[model samples]
Target: MTTGMEELAARMRDFAQAREWEQFHTPKNLAMALAGEVGELIGEFQWLTPAESSSLDEETFDRVRSELADVTAYLVRLADLLGVDLIEATKAKLEENERRYDANLYRGSARKAPH
Candidate 1:
């Protein structure tokens, strides 16, 4: 069965194909675009306190949602072109993190785990 990420990637592929935008969607270009979108998303929260950031007004929240979608679209497209299985990669990374940062050792600590 196709995963949701795969379906999203397929749709993203079709979108670029339809627009003949693949030429502009090279990995580097996509990575840069993703960074830009992340910057926009960050800007949406830059002035807010932590609590305010979590409780954005409706208009601000909508803009945040749009920026997030932009970031995800670029990420999905980039992963698709590189033949990366995002879900599997995420799972593997989570497993590695679990091993590296045991909850009993790292819980409530903001510092990075020692190498």
Candidate 2:
């Protein structure tokens, strides 16, 4: 079964191709937009604590989701345009993170990695 997100991603790709926007969707530009959308997403919880943010009404939560979806949409578009394997990229990054946060040193710890 085709999930909704996958369908949406396909539609977004088709739309981009129809508009010839691929030329403008460079990695740098998409990355900047992703950051901006993330900032907007974070702004929604600017001063809210984990509890407060988590306790928000569904409507507020939906706003956060909307921002997150925007970020994800652009990232998906970039990956499609560049032929990037997002699944592979994500796994590679997580493996890098696991190596950096070695179990012996970071087991159950949440400290930032050394600078």
Top lDDT prediction, candidate number: 1
Residue 14 lDDT (model 1): 93
Across 1-114, the per-residue lDDT of candidate 2 in tens digits comes to: 766656766988788789998777888898888899999999999899989987988988999889989998988877766778687799999998888888788776656554
Q: Could you give me the TM-score of model 2 versus the true structure?
A: 0.78
How does model 2 fare in lDDT? Answer: 0.83
Q: Which ten-residue region of model 2 has the weakest summed lDDT? A: 106-115
Per TM-score, the best of the predicted structures is 1
Q: Give me candidate 1's TM-score against the actual structure.
A: 0.93
Off by over 4 Å in 1: 113-115
- Deviating ranges (above 4 Å) for candidate 2: 1-8, 113-115
Backbone clashes, candidate 2:
0
Candidate 1, 1-115: lDDT as tens digits: 9888888999999999999998999999999999999999999999999999988999999999999999998999999999998889999999999898998989878776555
CA RMSD per model (angstroms): 1.8, 2.7
RMSD of 2: 2.7
